[model samples]
Target: MSDVVLGVDIGTSSSKGVLVDPAGKVLASETREHHVDRPHPGWVEMDGGIWWEEFAAISRALVHDGDNVTAVGVSGMGPCVLLTDDGGEPLRPAILYGVDTRATAEIAELTRRFGGDEAILDRCGSALSTQAVGPKLAWVDGHEPDAMAKARRLFMPSSWLVYRLTGSYVLDHHSASQCTPLYDTDARQWYEPWAGDIAPHLDLPPLVWPTDIAGNVTAEAADETGLPEGIPVIAGTIDAWSEAVSVDAQNPGDLMLMYGTTMFLVHTVEQRVSTANLWGTNGAFEGTRSLAGGMATSGGITGWLKELFGSADYPELLLEAGQSGPGAQGLLMLPYFAGERTPIADPDARGVVAGLTLSHGRGDIYRAALEATALGVRHNIESMEAAGGSIERIVAVGGGTQGDLWTQIVSDITGREQLVPSKTIGASYGAAYLAGRAADASCAADAPTGSSVPYAASGPGVDIATWNPPSHTVTPNPGLRQDYDELYDLYRQLYPNTQAVQHTLARRQHRLSNATDTRSTA
Candidate 1:
């Protein structure tokens, strides 16, 4: 049987698994789709059980023929606050990535109790925000005491899956750094200094390098995944980090721009650079760091607009958007349907569409949505560069990259050439690469004691087959750039100017909708 490596990615909408050889070649891949349940307007939750079921299905599908699988690596949406009981059963659906802002009060309280923003950033490299796990944990403890009390351990999305497979509770340093007020990045260990007062009696998991071996897969997990028992299970990381690895983004100045349900941008940093606007953390690769920024809505905003406008699927919509020229022909949109992250940590931010005229058509509106998203990407890239992180190269990944118009718009907006991976499976391929490395190491170690072992290693950098510059680089037109620059200034001003009014209106709308549903049910 040929040696195989399995990579599993647990994302917001679905879980995908891939099988690959040692040379970074993908053999087969499978994806299982699921929905995110939004009980409250701002609250987002997904059943952890569903993730595991999908994972099992994907694993079985990939390893059905009993290939010689040596190792496995997992990655998923990050900084999640997953509450599991003593026996490792999820008490409630896991709270998703930093995009979910139900913990706004917790963030403010943390800042108040801890000296201030600087103090937290000094310790964790990231200021208090609703995105960090510490704040979310505080929210659970305060609001869901029953679930909190039953919680024996907390894991990020990836950590939860590893614990399920190998019964080891651990998280990578990159992911753990996001647990502000709890983890000490300098020490590379959990800081119990505030763990007690923050959440009394809460036990933090051990932090490890993303590639460190957590444990061997248990017999039960092996049976489900169709792999041999006792295979080493590597401690994985957040999806963004894994995507970076997949594209050989190991060095500083290499940026990983992911376009999934949302857009996530992370760039490696040589030193810890603090930015009051962006997020900074230790890198997935040992001894490095990262500056991260994200937008609340990217592909999600596009999808919502698709349904609202009654447009065809994404491909067809892209075709129509191509008909519209630059500037969206006098239509400007703010892609903040969910909220805004990165530059403005305003959860109250809402979407806006200005410059709409009777002359505008559906194509113009569609073009505006794409341009709005691309402009948001540009905003983040500039913020990252200003904060001491360079972006010499950017590797784009995700379903959104399929839209040439979207990619061109992002390049023209940011004025940086974008590289798209030949194999679009960013995170899954990265997970497989990590696994293949482990397999090689295992083979080397078993060969001899104290003697050098011979075994081929995984590919050094990103497979070029998965990456190439676009045929035509979209150079920023001076006229369009100047116009968008002025419009973007206005776009940034909209959030603070309208935050209060937007929040009030959102609350009233929420109440009214609830009352109407209650009346109808009665």
Candidate 2:
């Protein structure tokens, strides 16, 4: 009787595996790091082979003591577009989620051909943008046709891992929605008519809920992953959605705010929503709807600052930020470090730091970064609210929420209370819970047990007692709120103000990067 369950998370920077018991307790875990190749500026490619290799290494590590694993679940970064042949061999490196933005031309073409702005929104629930799989598929068709021709199937990050595990090609509904013109959330099926015309060469897999049974793990996968040959595999979802599951984001207005390589918010709504500022779609849970917003940079901005200053001690920096007073003394940063995605949907949106002066030090800058991310969150919350999604409470999860300053900043900016999960490892834990449910219904059968261990002041990974409320709740200060209201107005305008400049710079940077790559190959 194998009782242990395994959850594998394929992230932007690394792959993590966690083994857990029925009660949401992590027994053992493993991680394997991987790298992305910047073949050209504005493009990010990672070897799918590296993903599988790392998963194998971590699987061996996770089961070193030989626990009885009943089922395995896989989750990964969202909206990633991968090209693979019928037999599941990679034709080209994966164009990862949010980071790569070389699909501007395709987006324009899509907008022109699909319909005017209003019609496009009505059909796909989002305007054509780099985040949409339709545009990325168009990019491959126009520039990388050989890869596209060879591709008999396309998989998002999570779907790719599940395919390797079960030899079944499937995507959860949440990920499928990002395919934009290809998926119809209302119909709950692939929109073959539009898909055939728009992306005729692309192959889309079957859509299912995140917890649906994809298939039994194959013998080959078992040999590679050190698991039993016939374990059941679930159709896991985008990392953010899985994280929502981990936190029990089930109510009508519950929002899951994930701060990882990017800052993504998924709000569960009782009814369908359509908005110009946010992407709305069917949730992974059956019969539910969702509104999603993403900012292309969150921890990426913080990581950039760390690299610029050459420091590995970020926790200490957070402590230093705690010493600084609110608003970072009027130092406001717009964290568009990786360009903007939601609301404005401008791939060329750039980062901005206003009100910087000689008096400000590293702590002020760090605090400003946190404030910028929170402002982005506030923007998303407003968009969702405008689109008719009620946001009564927010559940904060992911690597970024470990910082008390970050969580409080979001709480203050959004002007809503935040509930930080006791276990911040949202996706990994959600995958584990899926596996546990697959093993036997009795294991954490209730969706979102609301049984969480609260985060202490230490950080994301630090342990604290379960059943406790959030360490501290932040209410928006009226004075700072007035100032931020003004700052956010300026933050909203930054994109339009700099769009033309950013476009020119992005093109130049792309050309230079392509020339360098060509020279290297020569």
Candidate 3:
């Protein structure tokens, strides 16, 4: 029987699973697509039950006859707030990451309570932003006290899966580090005093590294998923970090650029680094750290254009966008349709199409949207560098990287070469690789000393380079550098110049939404 590891990742839009042999070959893969619920203007959520249901479905579909499933690995979109009771039942739909801006008031209150922005940044490695989990918890405490009172524990998708599969409630260090004001990056542990003050009634899980074995799959999970009992299950992390590990981008000086619904940039650094514009968190692996940045929307904006334009598919749009050329035919877009995340962290920011005219077609608008995301990438790269992150190499991953135009645009806008890996399956593949590592370690531990078995003789570890190598590189076009540089300046200035108007519009939109909700409820 061939030894295979199973990996499953719950994402913002879908859940994906993969079965990989010891040699890094994917034997089978499965995906289950789902949508998030937008209950309010800035609220994005999904039912926590969907994660395990999709996992079981994908697991059963991937595991077949003659394939011996050795271990399990998991990853998910986080750092989400999935408060649950002591029995692990969710109190409400999981509040998503930075994209969900419903916690702004809580963020402001927490920042003030924590002694201002500088003190929080110095202690927690990040200020109280929509991304931080503590503020989201506080939002729940203030808004839904009944639910908050019943909440006995906290769990993200990854940790929730770990607990369901192995009956162990634990969170990886990388995920915990994002729970700002609760996890101390300097101490690499939960700050009990702050946690007590914020979520005094809740019980925090034990911490583990992403690669650490949380526990073994129990008989119940094995029965449901058609896997053997007692297989080791790793305590996985957030999807972006797993995506980084998928491409060997966890080393210092390497940046993993994830082209997805939201553009995410993870720059691995050797030591703790913090800045007002970027996030500082523990690396996916132990003994390392990372500076990260994310934009609120990237492919999301393009998708919106596709729907608005009534396009049958993306290839046609890409071809037309290509013809529209570098300057996007005199159109510029802010790409803030869902509000901005890193560098700006402004939830009130609104999308702007500055140069649009009657002559502009759908193709020109599409090209501008693409360029807008590329410009956003460049902005984040600059911010990461300004925060002392060195980007010696950029590894591109995710579904958006499948197309050439997007990657080329990013390379041209950022003036950097991007390495596209052989497997862009993203986080599911990375989780499988981690599972393979854990399984190999278990084999080595049980094997006799100096045994001739392959697991023991060849060393029980998985190398990411062996799993996924760079298939090609996208180099920037030097001729367009001067033009893009000038456009980037305009892109930066457009936000500040239009900030007050955008804020006022945002407030008006909020009031209208509230009125609509009140009418509906009545």
Query: Highest lDDT: which candidate?
Result: 3
Q: Output the TM-score of candidate 2.
A: 0.91
Per-candidate local distance difference test: 0.78, 0.76, 0.89
Clash count per candidate: 3, 2, 0
TM-score per prediction, in order, is 0.92, 0.91, 0.97
lDDT of 3 at 470: 85
Query: lDDT per residue, candidate 1, 282-331, as tens digits?
Result: 88767888999988878887777788877477777777788888788877
Worst 10 residues of 3 by lDDT: 448-457
In angstroms, the error of model 3 at 303 is 1.5
Tens-place lDDT per residue, model 3, 1-522, is 888999999998899999998888998899999999998888899999999999989988988889888878899998999999999999999999999999899889988988998888887888888889999999999999999999998999999898889899989989999999899999988999899999999999989888777887889998888877787788899999999999989889999999988999999997889997788999888788899999988988888888888844799999999999998999999988888999899998999999878988888999999999999999999988887878899999999998899999999999999999999999999999887877675444233211211212233347778889889999999999999999999999999999999989999989999999999999
| Residue 352 shift from truth in candidate 2, angstroms | 1.6
Stretch of 10 with least lDDT, candidate 1: 445-454
- Candidate 3 residues lying further than 4 Å off, grouped into runs, are 441-461
